[model samples]
Target: MRQYRHFDNVLLVVFFSHPRYDVNLDYYERTYAEYFPNMVFVGPASREDAGFNHSYDVIVDSYGSAENLTNPEFYQMAGRMAHHMLFTVMKDHPCYHGYLWAPFDTLLNVPRLQQFDQNRFWYHSPFGEYVPNSALESDQDPDLHAPPARISPDPALNLTEDWKGWGPDWCDPHVGLPACLPAFRKAPSSQHRRLASFFENGTERFLGGSSDTLYVPGIHREAFLETLALFLETECFMEIALPTTVHLVVPPSERILFVDHWWIWQPPFNATFVRMKWEEGFEVDTFHTFHWGDAAEGESWRAHPENIEDVRELLQESARRQGVRLPVATSQVTGRSPTASSLLPVDQRQA
Candidate 1:
């Protein structure tokens, strides 16, 4: 077991990469060194480190097989591997205060990086309506139900009536990919119908109204997954295991905040939100990290260098406010190249 030296509330940014996106890592390192000096980057050891001493708080051992949509089991294994990596970090570095795990393409916008708060998990609510233990197994559980409020399913669509029910806090009017909505309405699978009903009903009922949008910020991680798993087992709803619900996690407390309007599958929407963040100056104040999901897409941070620069400036400013200097490095460090092993065949890797 590797012993990691203790640090005050470290920000752990996670990523898995291929050869083509190595440049993304290079730029990320440079930006981190220049702008956010207080933070440390942890990643895998490379072949080039033959005799060289590289400093990293943690290193992921196996790269695991790549994911493919066509093959369900392979894809599921890949996701499991990703989750394992996160769990490894949590287990090994319990002393560290908070973690911000994201794909490599994620960018930092503000200079003052908000340290993670362990007590509260931050992420964006997938369902626009906030429902309490709706995520939990039963409404009777005191741990899940808190209060009641009127929630509208669609914030985009104006509904005059608000329905009262038990639900989580933090409902926003952001439904993912419009195309997905039709599928839910047509086939009406439990997952699909739940999504459609959320849109149609406009309000989620539960105790303790929406937690607050700022609470849930980013990708679904270990804590949130565990919570969901517990909820599904209790409710006997196996569909929650589907990949679509990956982002649906509990609402975060005000102390722990999540920057919003970013998703893994959607690109144009994320770009638009980023632009909005830049315009409003909100990005400078609150956000520390920006995830550009799916390196293969056109909306990737790699494709939008200008946006990356905007984020870089934010990180620099944040560093200055925090009174910390990022480690400066001149030599270029490239991430591992994509290989046959790295690229698990679509048939073998899809889950």
Candidate 2:
């Protein structure tokens, strides 16, 4: 087993949102602090206290003075903007080698973290092969290196030179279906015809960009900004934007590793522990970032109690496998006991 040590050049960004029953501050404090303590936590003002309370190394208050309508659509856009802001912030600080947008509610499988190589870009796999063929055509076009023209002609909306070529339709079918279908259905007759006409011709223009890549922070800052700009043009979910940008810039051979088996879902009311599979080498298993209608619901395995227990056992088992002995509880020499099961490794028999 490889020993995991914190990298000072890496910046771990945690996107924390409010009105979330699933946000586990304690877990983040214990897990992230132990591994990647130098972190920047970004979240909406509604839950600013949560981040501040955790004593995070850096707490960024998203939506500080911005005033906008509070609705589902606005919320979705806000979430996307939060990610964009994080990237922009990173642009100013060039000392970091990589950046990580870790989901707030996910539990860290430490042994798995030990195996992570920061040199590669990591991202989520596609939701399934539902994108139109045309969308994929440009993926191989060498000319696509140049960012697309500005998303809008409005001077006020004009993105910086590095921020051009952002537009939409870059997600897998399953992920985009729910978002696109509703807009397609609610449109007036003219808009409906436009959407219908596009799909009838082929959704390649709409569905071709990559939405999820497991790791991406290792690219040069300029390339990262360019990739981010391309995704912004799509005005799609950042999950889709991430991989879409990577596909645009990263060579096929050097593309980031993908998290295939990891499950990211909303923890149900009954979930008592984190749910994951230790058997699978998931790059990052995320859960409960935000509960957006049906979008939040995910795989059943994410909430099963058995699987949750398995996650715990896997952590301890992995520790033992790594030749790390759990500290004996109720130590006679120091009279100290372990405080956390997920983080602190301690012998259960002597407790």
Candidate 3:
């Protein structure tokens, strides 16, 4: 007998900015709400923005408030940073299993989520575990870089001189030190000492000598949240900061799932184009569509007019078979094709 998890078993958190509000948000809201009833939306919203209708059951507008502690230096990555902080604030929710950081643009087909192992961490396969000198080679590939510059091979493990500007208290407003401090204190003292030691001394050893990104596979709630809280208090990219901190303490039992949703898209992506794909049936358990206000890269089949029509037909048929109308659009607003908007450009997509 196969068992699937219920909506209440997992809390889905979706984050986006005001700039991306109009772009297929209504579609995402309707589709996801029907798909996963227990979901929340978080973003930077002003008083003017608050009165508008949002699709999710709960909305956390973290703008123009002291709680909005997003780093300006990483403005391009603020949405992701906001996501990490959102987890911190909502970690204690009764969702017995765990939570997922769902990109606002992603259209997931999780027919088997009930079988998902809560302790298992989920990530894509593109970024493998950094194994010393061997893993760093990928950063040197010109095809991987848009401008062709060298990036730190292992941004997670290495702390180079370029990080001088990173000071403590970088994301304090968002993570809420006062709230997390009690949890931090509750964590074993040994964990605290080791994390402090690494932050102060271990960085010099793995200096990569250039600006590059880093990624972490997964993070455990109750266990590592305090250490994560400490790391959030410091100046570090969330992607790099998370796994780096986790590596220092978490054991092997807490696993990471390297998910490969799709292949890499060609470079020089005009910042808006992405490569989206759909076949026989939406079999992919999880998917991350790259950007909300974007289209497919010029040549990809996902963007091809014929393929888009085929996918629309498939979606209609699938909805019919399931005994439901296609997720009806509530609002009149429509934007780019959902298939293209879902495809994220390779380099610019979140790690």
Candidate 4:
């Protein structure tokens, strides 16, 4: 991603490891060191190398670590747990303005890079206006993480009222969560528009949508961390839990839905517009996720991406959106033919 000049401004790049590979974090750090100097790896395995990070690890968010990888509930909620764990590692290193969470196979639209530029990352987030001066000005260059307001809560606990109290004393004000998420049941067999958890009040609706890729800032850091607990408590998948939890936390006075969802079919998108991330999307933070999961029971014709071709096609379209073609980004390092899985992510290729 550093191939693009805009990505050069990214202070730190973190790779959240899946539980299966958490045992050998140093190997990942040593192997990918050439890509970026400030890059680091976070996972359950890093627990073994305490010298590599803070003394503790994020076991709760590691999602079953190696024990419950096969458990569907634990597996689905694990994605959010990864975000929580990443937040834990990033809080100490306040050089970054915010964080972007995308799949290993994901690609940034060449044009979309401007929105995520270091100067504009906070503005493009959900609560852009809520950003504090400490995050923006740093006029005196004070310790952004260890502000005087921070109460030094026990970091050992996985779930808490405000995890690290990022909002209570750090931000402008703490706008409490919504009374409850709102949505209606769409009956069984539907992809969305249904209840995520078995609530006590029998509310059959929820704020549900796609969450494959997202960007968040310090304002909601702990709220994002508590999402896994909410998911498990609600007994729903990440899709429902994430969106509902996110919207629920937005301050009512500033709540707005920037996300866009789609129902797509076909793979390795043959045409320019097929399965596009919305032909005319939100100009500033336009983002759409192609459902990479299995087709619904009756919708057998839907294109289920089995390999990386669909992802490469997505990147090709991302380039086209900027009136350009996919560049030979890997050639700079490999010095080999650009055809050598240039678009295929290293992790997937190795897997």
Best by TM-score: 2
CA lDDT scores, all candidates in order:
0.34, 0.39, 0.38, 0.34
RMSD of each: 14.3, 13.8, 12.2, 16.2
Off by over 4 Å in 3: 1-8, 22-24, 47-51, 55-58, 61-77, 112-115, 125-219, 245-250, 261-351
**Which lDDT tens digits does candidate 3 get at residues 159-276?**
3333334432322333322223343344465654543443434331111111111122234565556556664554333443444444435454443343323322453221122122
lDDT of 2: 0.39
- lDDT (10s digit) by residue, model 1, range 1-351: 111222223344444432223344445554443322223333444423211323232254444424354753322223223433444444444333455555454544332234434445443333322222221244233223222223224423322233222121112111122222322233214433333443445342211111211222233344444543333332111122222232233332132233332333444423354445444433322222344323455333244445445555444444554455543223223333222111333234211
Question: How much is the lDDT of residue 138 in candidate 3?
Answer: 51
Residue-wise C-alpha lDDT for candidate 2, range 170-249, written one tens digit per residue: 22232232333332233244422432332344222222322212344555556667546544444445544454444444
C-alpha positional error of residue 71 in candidate 4 after TM-score superposition, expressed in Å: 7.7
| Ten-residue stretch with the least lDDT total in model 3 | 204-213
lDDT of 4 by residue, 1-351 (tens): 434343332323343344322222332222222222333334555344233333232222454234344754333323433444444554544444445544322233333344332322121222223222211233223322111111222222332354334332111111111211212121222222122222334333333334444555545555444543444432243344445444444443443322221222444323233333244332212223223333347642233333234434554555565455444333122322112322234333221
Model 2 backbone overlap count? 19
Tell me the deviation in Å of residue 226 in model 3: 1.3
Order by TM-score, highest first? 2, 3, 1, 4
Stretches of model 1 off by over 4 angstroms after superposition: 1-8, 17-21, 34-58, 61-64, 71-81, 115-119, 125-256, 264-273, 280-310, 314-351
Q: Please count the clashing residue pairs in each candidate, in the order shown.
A: 48, 19, 8, 3
Q: Give the TM-score of candidate 1.
A: 0.41
